[model samples]
Each structure stands twice: as C-alpha cells, then as structure tokens.
Target: MKQFTISQEHISTYPNPIILKKGEEVYYGKEDTEFPNWIFCKSISTRKSGWVPKQILSTPNNSGIAKVTKDYSAHELTVNQGQTVFGIENLNEWTYCKTQNGEFGWIPSYCLSST
Candidate 1:
C-alpha cells in the first residue's frame, strides 16, 4: 500500500477526469508503466485514474499505465500551482498526462514544475 501526495492542484473535466490539489493523498495502482518516471494511480476516495511521477510515489515502481485512458482525449486538463504530472507525450502548448483518476488529456504547461 503506497501513498502519493499532490504538490499542487490539477484540474480535469468531470465524468471523465479528476481534480486534485496539494496535500492530497493518492493510491498507487500498478508498477508496469507506459513512460519513464510515470506510474499508474487512482484517487484514494474518488477512484479517478491518472499518472504520477515515480519520484513522488512512496515506492520507486508500483503502478501500471492504462493505455485506454492515454488515448489523449479532449483537452480537459489544467495544471496549476507547481503540480507534478507524469508526462506521457507533449505538444507545443499542450501536454498529455494521466489524470489522478486514470484519464489522459491535454494540459497547459505554464503552471507545471517538474518534481
């Protein structure tokens, strides 16, 4: 049982995404990964799917990346306040990241700081 903490806020579209903030705790799901420094995870209470950084996770490797969620659906993510995200792919302005609830979407880069 590993716990992950959010360093900042991450907002995603509801019904398909998640919103997490600093001081929040997340549950590590699978270690098998899709990208380096990224791990599959879920929100402790809401059960949202997303990806978190390996450095921030309690264990180095203990999560799995869900490919279905990584489809890079609608641009519904807004990274803010020094949030750390497992970057799967990146575009010029938007970045594909796993949501805390296991969803992938495009998020802005202005508000992110690598952990």
Candidate 2:
C-alpha cells in the first residue's frame, strides 16, 4: 500500500488515541465498509495503527498542483485524504488550504507536488 506523510498534527478520531505528528508517514491499512471517513492505517515511526480520515492524504502528484501527500497538522477542519482542497496561501512548511466544503485549514507543503 502507498504511504503518506502527516500534513498536520492529527488526533485520530478513532481508537488507540495515538497522536500523529506533522511529517509522520502512515502506511495504508484496510478500508472499512461501515465508515469511509474512519479508515485504518499503521504508523511507520510509532508502530501504531488506527482509523484516519480518507481526506488527509495526497500522492506525489496530489492535484492542487499535484496529488497531495503530507501527514498531519493542528488545523481545524482537517481535509480528508481524497478531498479536493484549495490553497489559500503557500506557507513554506504548511500551506493554508480550503476544502470544497468551504472548510479552511493548513496542509503540509510536502504533500503537494508541482503540476
């Protein structure tokens, strides 16, 4: 499975309550049929696994410029893995982005690739 780094600090909305930090790479776990948002993945650094929002992810080509990637952040309105986010401003480490739902927050710059 593909891995993505945390774009901002994420307090898993699921169990184990492990605090995920910005830049931590989490391996993709199995998808849940019941809840789409609370899917699980294991952490490479901490050796912990739990459900995370599908929005907080991006690929090498993660499309805002590319596909998104970074791991976690302390922003409110955290974007789900595959959600399309609009950049409000490009900060060096964290880029301020707004979700299509009109939610605003910070996503890590490493997550976005140059298109």
Candidate 3:
C-alpha cells in the first residue's frame, strides 16, 4: 500500500477513498454504489456516466511509449479512477501507448488503473 496525505480532517475518516480538491484534475476510480462519485458541473448540462475522476492528479510519467499486449476484461477493470482502460486501439488485443515524456511500451489494460 502507498501512503498519501489528506488535505482536510473532515474527510480523513473514509478508507481507500480518493480525495479531490476543487480545481484539481485527477483520474476516475471504481464507482461507489453507496455514494455518487464525480459531481457534474451543472453549468454545462451533460448526462451522468456514474463515474468520477479523482480530484488528485497523478504525477506525470516521464517515459516514452508502450503498448498493451493482453486482455483483462474478465478482471472487471472498469473505467474507474486510475483505471487506464480508455483511449486504446484494441479493446481485447494489444494496444500502443506513448508517454508524454518519451518512453514507449505496452501494458495489459488490467495491469493499469491499479498498482
């Protein structure tokens, strides 16, 4: 498990929950049936997708490019927070990805989103 700092004591009581600050950009995680995740900005009306991107943005990777070489649909790795299953070329096959920095490689869509 990794350690993270909480910005507010009011929200520290929750376990394994992603914290979001206003104006911060983050990734989406698994949907919480008990509590709605991402709150839509009503100023721009849009249909709810029942998912929330984490408010805490991840540190940008300084790698090159890579590709996803396997299938993990059976793992139930939905398009949640840190779930890097989106924007792929093949949903079930290997897909190529390029890092914003410079690294290039492939990863099982499932291996992502989580650790």
Candidate 4:
C-alpha cells in the first residue's frame, strides 16, 4: 500500500456507484470530455451507471455492449485537504484509496501527494 496526503478537497458526485464484476456486460456510453480515458457505462445486470476507466473494459461492439475485464467499483471518496489515505489501485489518473475512517473510494491522482 502507498500512503498519500490529500492536497486538495474532492467531493464525490456519485453516491450510488456502479459495481461491476469480471465478465459482466455493460452498455457503453459517451466518453468524459474533461477526463480522458474514462467512459460512462451502465451495468446490464443492475442497470446502474457510472464513470469507469477504459482500461478495465473490453472492446465494445457496434451496438455498444462490452464486457468488464476486471472487477471494479466506481465509488468515489469525498476527501478534504490535509487528510491522508492509502492507495489501493491506480487507474486512468485516479487512485482508489482507503481513508483512516475505513472509507474506500476513488480520488483524482492530482489531488494527492506521496506521504
């Protein structure tokens, strides 16, 4: 695990995140213009939608259906400046982190610094 300090405050936009399992099918949607390599996807099983890193998604067919290449949770943690977190995974410029309070979610890499 890597330790990091939150350099800037980050608020999670999505409360109910989309959780996906490996080999699960999803409906691919538009890519985020502000964040490159992140795309909006709707899970076929739960019908929940969230931004997912493109790295974990398999190539989509013409109809925009794709398989998840790995298990992923789209949860985002609301962090404040000066807080510390442990990074669990890094993908598409975002870091999945665990807070001292036992909360886990994703935060933008730019908002964190190595501690």
lDDT of each: 0.51, 0.50, 0.27, 0.94
For model 3, the stretches where C-alpha displacement exceeds 4 angstroms are 1-88, 91-93
- Model 1 alpha-carbon miss at residue 59, Å: 4.4
Residue-wise lDDT of candidate 1 within 6-113, one digit each (tens)? Answer: 345667654465444444456656554334555566766567766554454454234432222222233455556544456676555445677566755666554455
lDDT of 3 by residue, 9-47 (tens): 211122222222344332223434443332221111221
Best by lDDT: 4
Whichever of 1 and 4 has more TM-score, that candidate is 4
Candidate 2 Cα misplacement greater than 4 A, ranges: 1-15, 60-115
Candidate 1: where is the Cα deviation over 4 Å? Answer: 1-15, 55-115
Output the lDDT of residue 26, model 2.
69
Please identify which of the two predictions, 1 or 2, would achieve the higher lDDT against the true structure. 1
Cα lDDT of model 1 overall? Answer: 0.51
TM-score against truth, every candidate: 0.36, 0.38, 0.20, 0.94
User: Where is the poorest 10-residue window by lDDT in model 2?
Assistant: 59-68
Candidate 4 residue lDDT tens string, 1-115: 9999999999999999999999999999899988889999999999999999999899999999999998899999999999999999988889999999999899999999998
Candidate 1 residue 33 Cα shift, in angstroms, is: 3.2
Stretches of candidate 4 off by over 4 Å are none
